[model samples]
Target chain A: MIETEQLTRCYGSLTAVDSLTLRAEPGQVLGLLGPNGAGKSTAMRMIAGFLAPTSGTARVCGHDVRRNPVAAKKALGYLPEGAPSYGEMTVREFLSFIARVRSVGGDKGYRRFDEVISRLQLEEVLDQPIGMLSKGLRRRVGLAQAILHNPPVLMLDEPTDGLDPNQKHSVRMLIDAMARQRTILISTHLLEEVHALCNRVAIIANGRLLADATPAELERQSRYHGAVSFSAQGSGVSREMLARIPEVASVEVDPLDGRVTVFPREGKPILEEVQTLLRTQNLEVSEIQLERGRLDEVFRHITTSAHPGPAA
Target chain B: MSAVFAIVRRELLSYFVTPVAYVFMVIFLVLAGLLTFYAGDFYDRGLADLQPFFDIHPWLYLVLVPAISMPMWSEERSSGTIELLLSLPVTIAQAMIGKFVAAWLFIGFSLMLTFPIWITVNYLGDPDNGVIFAGYLGSWLMAGCFLAIGACMSAATRSQIVAFILTAAVCFLLLLAGQPQVLDFFQDALPAKMLGALAQLSITRHAAAIARGVLDLRDVTYFVASIVAWLAAGVALVDLKRTR
Candidate 1:
C-alpha cells in the first residue's frame, strides 16, 4: 500500500535521508527503529506529501507524492513528529475541521469521530481548547485526527514517544487494533513497542537500512540463538560434562547460582541433548530454558558493530 | 469547494477567538475616525461629499492591513501547524485562496461598519451615494492588494514581526511609486514612456480613479490583477517553504 524508492533528501552538504527504500503492505505494521536523527521523520514527511524529496519517488497507494500531492495525501494519515495542532481550536472543533477537510462528514463522519474520540479517551477534554490539554492528551488528539478519516496508510513518527507507561500501553493497543486493517509505518526508539505491535521490523542507522525482516528472522541471526541455560542444584551435571557433549562449543557457569549457560558450535540446537542429560542423569534443575534470542542484542550489534554504511 | 470553505471558516473563527480581531477592529475604527474627522478636515471643508473620508484610506490601510494579514501564514509557521495544514488533502492554491478570502471578507466587514459615517455624511449634506459606494469598493479592493503583499511576506518568514516590517517596507515603496520623487530617481535613467508607465503602476493612481467615481476597467483590472498576482506568489511561496 506504500512504497518509496531511492528516496534521498539532502540539506546542503548534509544528507538527512539517504537513498531510503521502504515498503509496508496492507495489514502489516512495520516498526522503523533508529537512534535520534536517523531521518525517520524526514522519510515519513516525504511520503506523506508534506516535504518534497530531493530525488526519487514516494508513493501512497499508487499516487506519487510530488506529482499528485492531493491524492497522495488523501491516502495517508500522518502524525507529525511533534503532534502539532491548531492550539486555538477546541478538540471537537479541530477534529470537525479535519473531518471536513478529509470529507469524512455526515452520518458516517459523526460515527467515525465518536469512535476515535472514545478510543483515544478524549471525552472529558473534548470541549476544552487544545492549547490547555496535557501533552499526553494532545498526542491522543493528534492520533484521533489522523485516524478520523480511516485512510489506507498511516505514517506515525514517534507515536508513543512521550506518554507514560499506561498511556503508552493504550496507544500501543490502539495501534495494534488499527494495524489489522490499514498499513502502519511507525518509527520508534523503543524496541518493546516493536516487539508488542510490529509484524515486521526495519533497523536503520545513519539514514540507511541495515536490516529489514520479521522478528523471528532477526532473532535467528542473533549469536545467542540455540543457546541453552539451566540452573542446576544437584544430580552432578557439571559445566565440564556439558562442554564435553557433541556440538557444545562453550560453557559459562554462574558462581553465585551454579547455573550453566551453554553455547553450541555451528549454531546447533543443544537444548534437546541437554534435556536428555537432565532426564538420564536425574539432574535436579531449578531453571532450564533456551534463549529465543534478544532483539536488543541484534539491534545493538547491527547498529553499532556494523560499518556506518555509504558516506554522505 | 467545501474543502476551501472549511479552511476559510477555520481561519475566520481563529481570528475572532483571540483578542487579535477585536483589537485590530478597535484600532482601525479609531484611526479611521481620527484621520477622517481630524486630519482630513471633514467638517472644516464643509463639502457635501465623503472626499476627506476616502482621502486618508491609502495611508491608513498601509499600516493597518498588514497588522491584520501578517499572522495568516506566520502563525501557521511559528506554531508548527503549517505542517498539519500541508499534510491534509487540500492543495496549496486552495489553502491560500481560502485564507485570502477570509481576510478579504474581514476587511470588507470592517469597511461595512463605516456605513454610519456615510449616513452621517448624507444627513449633513446631499452626498452622491453612487460615488460613496465606488469609494468604498475601491478602498476594499486596494486593501486586498495590501493584504496579499502581507500574506506573501508572512509565508516567507516564521516571525510575524519580520513579516509585518517587510510588508510595510514593500508597501511603502509601492506607495512611493506614486510620488514625484520616484520620477526624479528614474527620470534620467529611463525614458519618459517607461517613467510614465511606472507612475501608472502606482497604487494611488488606480485608487484615486475609483474614489473619484471613475470605475475605469484599467483601474479595476489593476487591483484585481495585482491581488491575483500577489496571491499567486503567496501560493508559490507556501509550496516553497513547505519543502524546507
Candidate 2:
C-alpha cells in the first residue's frame, strides 16, 4: 500500500534520510527499527506528506506524496512523534476536529468518532480536557485521532513509547487487529516489540536499511557458532579436558562455581559427546541447554557496523 | 471552503472556551469607550458625528488587534500542533485564510460591542447614523489591516510575546509615518511625492477619510490590499516553514 523509491531528506549539509527505498504491503506490519536520529521519524514524515524529501519520491496507495498530497495523505493516518495535540480541547473535541479536517463527515464522521473512542477506550476521559490527561492517555487520544478516518495506511512513530506494559500490550493488540485490513508501518527502538508484533522487520542505521527480514531469519543470520551452557558437580571435569573434546571450539569455566559454557563450531553435535565424557569422568551433570541467539544481539551487531548518520 | 469554515468554527469555539476572547473584548470595549469619551473630549467638542471615536481606532488597534491575533499561529507553532495542522488534507492557503478570517471576525465582534456608545450618542442628540455606520466599517477595515500584520508577525515566530512586540512595533511605525513630526523629519531628505506616498500607506490617513462618512474606493482598496498582501505573506511563510 506504500512505496518509496530512493526517498531521501537533507537539511542543508546534513542528509537525514539517505536513499531509503522501502515498501509495505497491505495487511503487513513493517517494523522500522532504528536507534535515535536514524531518520525513522523523517522517513515516516515523508511518507505522511508532512515533510517533503529533498530527493526521490514517496507514494501512498498509488499516489505520489508531493504531487497528490491530499489524496496520498487521505489514504494514510500518521501519529507524529510526541503525538502533539491541542491541550485546551477535550478528547472528543479534538477527535471531532480532526475528523472534520480529514473529511470524514456526516454519519461516517460520527460513527468513526464513536468507534475510535471506544476502540481506544477513551470514553472515560472523553469530556476532560486533553491537557489534564496522563501522558499514556494522551498518546491513546492521539492514536484515536489518527485512526478515526480509518485510512488504508497507518504510519505510527513510537506508538507505544511511554505506555506501561499493560497499555503497551493492549496497543499492540489493537495494532495487530488493525493490521488485518490496513498496512501498518511502525518505527520503534524496542527490539522485542518487533519480534512480538511485526512479521517483517527492517533494521535501519545511518540512513540506510541494514537488515530487512523476519525476526527468526535475523537471529539465524547472526549465528556462526552455537554455545551450550551447563552446570555440573564441582568435580573431575577440568576446563582443559572439556576444551580438548572433539568438535568443541572453546570452554569457559566459572571460577567460583562449577559451571561451564561450551562453544561448538557449526555442524558439531558435541552435546552427546559431552554427555559421554561426563559419564566417563563420573561427574554428575546437573543441567545442560542450548543457547538461542536473541534479536538484541542481532540488532547490536547490525547497527554497530552501520555508521552513525546525521540527525533527522 | 468547508475545510476553511471548519477551521473558522474551531477557532471561534476556542476563543469562546478560553478567557482570551473575553479578556480581549472587555479590555477593548473599556479602552475604546474611555478613549473615545473621556480622553478624546467628545462632549466638549459636541460633534454630532463619530469622528472622535473613529479617530482613535489606529491607536486602539495597534494594541487590541495583536492581543487577539498574536496567538493565532504562534500558539500552534509553540505547541507543535502546526505539524498536525499542516499534515491535514487542507491546503495551506485554506488554513491561512481560515485563521485570518476567524481573527478578523473576532475583532469585528468586539467592534460591534461598542453599540452602546452609538446608542448613548443617539439618545443624547441626533447623531448621523450613516456616518456612524461608515465609521464602524472604517474601524473594522482598519482592524483587519492590523490583524493581518499580527498574523504575519505571528507566523514569523513561535513566541506570542515576540509576535505581539514585533507587530506593535511595525504598526507603530506605520502609524507614525503619517504624523507631521515624523514626516517633517524626513521632509528634507526625501522627495515630496515619496513622503506623500508613505503617509498614504499609513492606515490612519485612509481610515480618517472613511471615518468622515466618505466611502472612498482608494481607502477601501488600501485596507483590502493590505489584508491580502499580509495574508499572502503569511501563507508563503507557512509554506516555507513547513518544508523547514
Candidate 3:
C-alpha cells in the first residue's frame, strides 16, 4: 500500500509538487496523469524517498517516508525517470549489485534473481554492459531491478515512455500481471497506457489533484462521452438532420476528416439513434465508434485550463 | 552494514572494470619509486628505511586521490543514478561512507603493491619493520583524509572536472597551510595563536610527524577527525545540492 498526505516539495520559491494527497491499494494500478511539467516525476520522487517533501508526509507499507526512510524504502521499488542505472556494469552485474544492496542473497535471493531476469526477458543481454543496450532493453533492465526485491509498492516514473509498441505491450502485460499483488504507481503522458494499465487514475495540474477516478469515470468527464462519431463514404450525412434528434445536443463535423459526430444531451446514449438515422437516410457510413470517453480531451481540458506548470 | 558492503563492492568492481584502477596504480607505484630514489637520495643517505617514500605521499595523493574520489558522487549525479542509489534502503551517510571506504581501499591497495620497495629495503639492511609499518599506516590515513575531502567536493557538483578542480584547490590549500612561505604570508594578518592553530590544520604536518616512525594519538586523531569532518560535510552537501 502507498499513501501520501499533502506531500509537497519546493525548490526555492517555486513549488514543484503542491499539496497532493493520494493512495493506492494492493490491487490498484494508479496511473498519475499530467501534461509536460505537471510535477508527475517530482511527486513520484517524493513517494519513492529520493526527494524529501517540503511539507506533509508519505508512507509506504506503514513506514513514514521522512521519519523512517530506510524502512519505507525497503518496502518500495522505484524506477526513476529515464531508467538510470550503472551503465558501465553488465546487466547481470548491475542486477547482482542491486540484489546485494537489497540484501537479497543466498538461495532465496538467487531464485528471485533468476525469476526476475527471466520475467523481464533479460537473459540474452545479461553479459552485455547496460550502456550498450538499446533504449527499450535498458528500460526492461530498469524494470527488472525495480521488481528484483518484489516490494509491495512499486513507483515507476514513465515505465514505458520510450519503448516500441511491442515492448510497450509486453510491459503493460507485465504490469497487468503484477497489478493484483502490488500497488503500482506509474506516471505517464500516454493516455493509451492509462487505459491499458491503470484501474484508477489521478490527474494533476499545477501540482494539485484535478481529478481522481477510474479510467472510465475520467473518460466520462470528456465531452466525447456518450457521443457517436461516424465517417461517411462521401459528405452524404446531413449535420442538421442529426442535430434535429431530440436527445442530440450538437452535431459536429470534424474539419480534418469530414466525419460527423452527434453529441448526446447530458451523456445520453446516442449510438442507437445515430445508427437508425444513418440506415433510414440510406447514407454510406464507412466506420463509427461510440467513445467511452476521450481521455486525451479530458487530459487537455484538465491540464491546459489550469495555469502552465513548470517541469522538474 | 550489508548495504555499505554492497556499495563498496560495487564501487571497487567499477574501478577495476575500467582501466582506471590499473592506470592509477601504475602511476602511483612509478611516481613513489622515482621520487624516493631521485629526490630522497636513498643511496647517499645509506638508510634502508622508507621514510622518504612516506614523505612523498601527501603530494602524490594531492594530485591523484581526486581521480579516485571525483567520480564518487559526480558521475552518479550526472548520469541520474543518484536517484536510484539514494532510493535504496541506504542512508546518505551509508552511501558516503561506502564510497569513501572503497576509494581509500583502492589507494591502500596501490600502496600495498609497493611491497617490492619494502622487500628490497628488508633484503639490503636491517630497517625497523615496526616503523615502516607505522609509516604505511600513517600514509594510508593521510590518503583517507584526501579522499574524504575529494568525496565531499564531488558531492557539491555534477561535473567531474569541476569536482576535480575544487578538490585539488582545497587540498592544495590544506597541504600548504603549515609551510613557512604560506605562514609568512599570513603572519602579519593573523594572531600568533591563530597562525599556530592554522599550521596544526595542515595535512602534511600531521603526515610528516607520523612518517618519523611514531604513531602519536594526536596524529592519529588528526587524520580520523579530518575524515569524519569532511564526510559529514559531504552528506550535508548531497542533501543540499542533488540534481532535481
DockQ of each candidate relative to the true complex: 0.69, 0.69, 0.69
TM-score of 2: 0.93
The regions of model 3 sitting more than 4 angstroms off are: A234-237, A306-312, B242-244
After superposing candidate 1 on the true structure, give the runs of residues whose Cα lies further than 4 Å from its correct spot. Answer: A230-245, A251-261, A272-288, A306-312
Which numbered prediction scores highest in lDDT against the true structure?
Answer: 3
List ranges where model 2 is wrong by over 4 Å: A224-227, A230-248, A251-261, A267-289, A306-312
* Real contacts recovered, all predictions: 0.82, 0.61, 0.77
lDDT of 3 by residue, A1-312 (tens): 999898898888888889899999998999999888888999999888888899998999999998999999999999999999998899999999999999999999999999999999999999999999999999999999999999999999999998999999999999999888899999999999998999989888768888888988888888999899999976435788888899999988878889888899997888998899889888888898987889899888878774643221
**Model 2 chain A weakest lDDT span, ten residues long:** A303-312
How accurate locally, in lDDT, is each candidate?
A: 0.87, 0.85, 0.90
- Please give the TM-score for the first chain of candidate 1: 0.92
lDDT of 3 by residue, B33-143 (tens): 999989978677899898888888888998999988999999999999999998999999999999999999999999999999999899999999999999999999999
What DockQ number belongs to candidate 3? 0.69
Give the alpha carbon lDDT tens digit for every residue of A57-134 in model 2.
999999999899988888888898899998988887888788878878998778878888889999899999999999
iRMS values for every prediction = 1.1, 1.3, 2.0
Q: What is the C-alpha local distance difference test score of candidate 2?
A: 0.85
